[model samples]
Target: MSEWDSGKNDGKPGWNDQPAAVADASEGKQSRQDRKLIDKLVMSMQVEQRRSRRWGIFFKFLTFAYLFGIVLLFKFPLGQGLESATGGMHTAVIGVDGPIAADELASADNIVSSLRAAFKEPDAAAVILRINSPGGSPVQSGYVYDEIKRLRAEHPDKKVYAVISDIGASGAYYIASAADEIYANRASLVGSIGVVAGGFGFTEVMGKLGVERRLYTAGESKGFLDPFSAEKPEEVAFWQSVLENTHGQFIAAVQEGRGDRLADDPRVFSGLIWSGEQALELGLIDGLGSASYVARQIVGHESLVDYSRTRSPLRNLVDQLGVSVGHGVAQYVSEQRLELR
Candidate 1:
């Protein structure tokens, strides 16, 4: 055999045998590299899976917390927890707080309901309307006034008294006039017997801004007292006449309620506010006292039970949201609003 074909030459491997060993070593190294790559891939996948699980758990916990908060809001309300503990003879107190609008806390519906409840209760000695407002809608005040009169006629034994706290004026006083006797603190503001309507004229502003008002109305007076349009003398006069007529009605109602108790001063019905002491002098208020004082002294009952009808928690929440959105919309669309205040 030749030296090249022999397995050994000079006790060392031949070139052909060296090539075979090198191929085997290269194959083994490639196998080890492939195994390391697979292990790294497996470890990377495990780490990603662990991170995803943690994030999923965190999101699930947050969702649970959000649901729990919603439940609590629905369960508890803001300010409505009045219990009628009329074990014996007690005085019924109905709160006429805030504006006296149809949708307000002192609405005619709420006040009438409270009045009826107080009058119907056998343990209630008398009904006291605890008022603290700057006044609002005349229609709402009129409704409450008429109801108080009717209830007073029905329940002749149980008297109805009005006790003004901080301030009671205009429509507030209108309702108070129907009471059997009215009372207020010495510094309380009382009486504003008049009607008013006001709005800003934006015609000049529109002219400066090069804005055109496109108003469509079928009737002649459909767009009466529009803020965007120019004011007409006849329309202004007509609006004034309407206000005077409403004022006349307000005066008549006050006269009928107060009778001879009112003073001869013309300023009493001139939309002027007066202190409780001045109101007493002008016959606007019968006495000077608080709800507690009237309850203990006039009604002869020390125990006072709230008979005010409060809005439900769900209704309050809905109203709050609605008012927030509606208020902005109202300001943008119509800045002019007719109110007693």
Candidate 2:
């Protein structure tokens, strides 16, 4: 090989342009380059993180501001037909449009609150309930009914009326009975004055499927109504008595509210729902009319104001999330056994 050629080195000092030293130097330079690239990547990641954090904060603030605005609107009544303290006469309408339960839209709290607000309004000539519900929890209906009675007694000059649109059965009818006058359309369903508790019997089904039912409770009668177990006669009698007492209370309330206007019909409190036309004959309802008709004819005020309390979007979203979680837990529980209360 030529002396200047560094292709193949002979066994000599300083041979092949110190190839070992040259390779070592190149490797050291590559190491430095790698460190620089790593540092650059780290800096880019930090910048991206900061940008993401800023956007997250912005959206959170936007959401909070939106919810705050809704709260303000609800509190201040931002031109949703709210009248001044000295404004002229107008009919105030509060809507009850769902099952009567603690957490439902037509709950006692919402209805009573709306009623109080409508009653407090100086320009309100009268208060009206626009009802469309299949009824629910008797306790919730009782609360609303009691409040209506109290509010009526407190403000005897201001009359409260119930106008049923679709279905006002059971607890809905219970609440409507407290009104000064109950009105329904010709086709509206009006009454189901009774108490009922029901559940399926799964003892035979479990036997057929060869599935075991396991239950643990501290009280002997705690699981009395378990579907997988045979029902005790004493427990059944106790439950029937409870239903009878509740039904008696319902009948008494109706009698007190309707007075002599109610026709002497045993079928009225027999858990049978009746059409508005049939209801009138039975004196379950006083008249046939819509909300508009009540506002114009009864209140003598054409302009109507709605005092219905409604859930905000954010609240509704939270409620939906809770319901989803509750459903999952309920399904898990139902798989174990069918419970009746």
Candidate 3:
């Protein structure tokens, strides 16, 4: 760009005197045009420089956000919200833990993390899953259950029990079923042995609103779950088959976990929820006991320790901020930069 600039004079002296009037007049007009052109070019270059700076800042900000906000900041929460500092002793009580997402709950977020911290202690006699979840993902619940099974297998002497305070239906119960024994209050709603995927029927809504759904995909089932389109019969069948397969897996796991403890009946897998007392009759749950009773009986220590991450308002805000940013990136990537609504 600099080489293109003709030094603002194009090899001419500061001022010319020995020239004809016509030559001088033509020269002046040409010089004026040249100056205007130079001014416009300089202005364009400055605009481009600013644009480049903004792009640089954008990339830099995103880089910092991924490093500091997502990765490093994510771990800081775990350290900041330690169970020891929260005054939990003897028995560990793990709460809802996280959003119940698969990867987060199992590997990075909550469930396994709580169990790990609890079991790592030398004095931890018995670990309790103080579950209060309406349930979320089957994948996550299965992972949590398997992890507990693994942990229990590794430490065969230790007892892992689940005490549901409120709701422990579906996936929550799936994990709880793997416990050595399950306890819940009489009023707690337990069991919803099923899988469900939800979405809106925007086919009619979009039709009425003159909205066009432009979903591009490479696989047959790629856009099958698209909310904007009417579900095809084959797609519905495919999903139903998938749901049936996953539901079978859940049932098998429960059967293997609870053995003859769980009553053999259709209602168990009928997607029906029952009170804890009712579950006991059905053999879905073993007994009615709170965290206190479990600790006193199983752990032999009356004290408690909340191995689960109980975050403060400030800590929660940071966690949520990181979560929202990560979710945005994940959503963007999953949708391939497309959004339905």
Candidate 4:
């Protein structure tokens, strides 16, 4: 009561007597600043997210373009499928490159189709089989040889020539023998007229490792040449007889194809290879020339057109993507096969 009466410094405001309006105004300013900072942070995050999304879309498009380019390249290679468009007289070239097998690029089905196409084309002056291989399956080679002969018989006016490059031996030569005349470079290797069947015997290794082999078969000779089992002398002799029969068939085909042009040399069919020069002397080849030289000098046609069968674009894509790995592995592990190598 005494302090009130004194009025505490005559109307001056004390520390605990501050006005409420001033405090409310200060708090309102701070709240507005905090709201502005939060809004700015949210906007910045959205901008960063948009930038990342744009980059992702751009990279996706780039990847798609790359794959599309690859597909186009596989679909249309240089100098392929131009025979129909060219529509003029040219030397038809059928390529028999790599291993001659049922599943290979130089397969019987592919080579046969190519021959038919070349023969059917009216603009084709002559057919040339361009061979470059180490030789593989005898069956495939036989099929190609028979097809070539039938095609030649059908179109007697047109001739089929075989031009070997690098090394064309065994199954490759088998196919070449069917041609009207065969040619090769002077240094090229020619003629490995033989049949071969080979495998590894793992029985001793398994026995040493204490590994038991349990193979089930329906027939007695079904597992005759199995690698895990002991090889019997009788089985080996039978296998040899089969090979000899195949070799005889091969020799007969060569003799029939070459006729009197082939020389009576024992070493020609002794499963030995010879240089192209030596081959010409032995009558294995008609002349020393390349595909172009044969086409220009022999066929009298300079322009060349490829009629070889190739894989489809879709199949090529699948192979490039490694989709056929399992199938290839299964084939590799299936069985032993006979080859003309």
Candidate 5:
């Protein structure tokens, strides 16, 4: 029998030796399949290696960029850099804007620091307080006024002027009065020589809503000014006297600052705001002009340098974060109370 037919025919090939050609063809097919599988695995491994390398490079660059940004933010003294950049013979301006309060931009601490820095500059011809504020916080205004006077006395050579932009009233006017000369635009509103405290009475509304205000205090007058409590005539009179005394102090400071320049009008210190022309006529302001006009015409220097202090970005971020967290906690508590109800 032929070698191929010598195999068992039990529905399968025999275990004996097969034909050489058939065996050779089967081995070639199996070798080709093995080669294809190996090639696919190698290709997959190459692709994976390339992807891993690309991701590794991306992460390295990202980490480097983040670190560089941190270095610039924390390691650099940006304030000093700004001061140095303003080098030259120029008029240094410290802005007194917004509500002059402890936490505001126009706070006493910020104004005084800016003034000190401006005055320390050798090339600064004069220091100008560029004011545009409705005013706030008597204590803050007083602190700024005292600092200006002290600085003026300390550096008589460096003249300090006040240039009113739009409005300089109450506490703002108080600060302006300490200047060597007060200038303003013809249309600018100037002067509000007074002290004030404001609040709203919510006792009647709370009573209508059936909301009881449970307040306890050791002193009888401790919670006297609470909006939910009824106004007492005695408390009212005492608060009025306090306001009047504060107003008196304000009038005295204005008089001392303006000296004989103020007019003999009784309404001048009656918390009245006047136009720049009227202010000049009343001697509340020295002249009708702007900062640019004063810098060019009065101080004889056109170059103006701002010495305004600002909170750092990081500090501002931290403050905002804290505020956000507090707000979130308060909101959560409010939601919990609503859920309970």
Candidate 6:
């Protein structure tokens, strides 16, 4: 049979046989071209993978640099933050905000310690205390008040004044009254000559739920204010006496610090709060002004050295990152507490 009609499916012998010597070289060249194309494609993929890894490394370095910058923010000195263009005069600000808590004060581990160090600066013309608080522990507030008084007496020529940003009530006002001059915005809240103790009444709900409060105490009134138990009338009277005594002390402090400046108003100590404008007319503050205005107009400088433990970069970053999440958690907890019957 002719090779073309062969039963086996093999190619025809004439066509399938290796190329003649003349055309053999061309076949070999074609095979090599195919192999080269495949090799080139493989090499390109490898190069792209390496480039991608290089890009990843570059981004990692950039992240590290950003973290380093955050660190530098906390490590730098006070005067470093302010620009030099504010002129030759340099004023210092000691911000006492948040609560009258021991941690936030001018004590050993508090704002006061930071101020003590900052006030030591020779070039600072005046030290301004920026107070923004609703008041807290009377003892803590009194501690800060006494320190400011002592510092002013020591630094006679260097003016140490206060500028209440928003709310400076009760204990906060007690401290502010000690300042050489108190300044506040027209809308800033100024005074609340009062003391308060707060707690929830859960006795009715506990009865509804058949929740019996069991306790063993050596003292007769040990758990006096416990929510699960009905509060006694005598205990109520005793607590009222305590509040009245504390309120009296708060009133005396304000009167002593304000001296002849305060108006002769019997209702000033009736647990009432006043706005900054009303406070000024009542002689609680020397003037109505902001920190910047007070500095430029009175102290004559926009430059200020913050006498606070400038937060660390790591801490600041954590605060920035955690603020939203922390707030959400706190809000949820508060809502749950509010929902409880």
Winning model by lDDT: 4
The clash count of every prediction, one per candidate, is 0, 0, 3, 0, 0, 5
Name the regions of candidate 5 deviating beyond 4 angstroms. 1-87, 314-341
* Per-residue lDDT over 60-93 for candidate 1, one digit per residue giving the tens place of the 0 to 100 score: 9989866765675667532333566647889999
Q: Tens digit of lDDT per residue, candidate 6, span 208-272?
A: 99898897888998987666688889998998897888777777777777789988888677767
Which lDDT value does model 2 have at 101? 73
Q: Against the true structure, what is each candidate's TM-score?
A: 0.77, 0.73, 0.67, 0.78, 0.71, 0.69
- How high is the lDDT of residue 332 in model 3? 47
lDDT of 4 by residue, 253-295 (tens): 9999998888899999989999999999999999999999998
lDDT of all predictions: 0.87, 0.84, 0.76, 0.89, 0.83, 0.73
lDDT of 2: 0.84
lDDT of 5 by residue, 129-153 (tens): 9999998878888899999999999
Q: Model 5: which residue pairs collide? A: none
User: On TM-score, who's better, 2 or 3?
Assistant: 2
Residue 160 error for model 3, in Å? 0.2
* Model 4 Cα shift for residue 231 (angstroms): 0.6
**Model 5 steric clash total:** 0
In candidate 3 the C-alpha lDDT for residue 80 amounts to 24
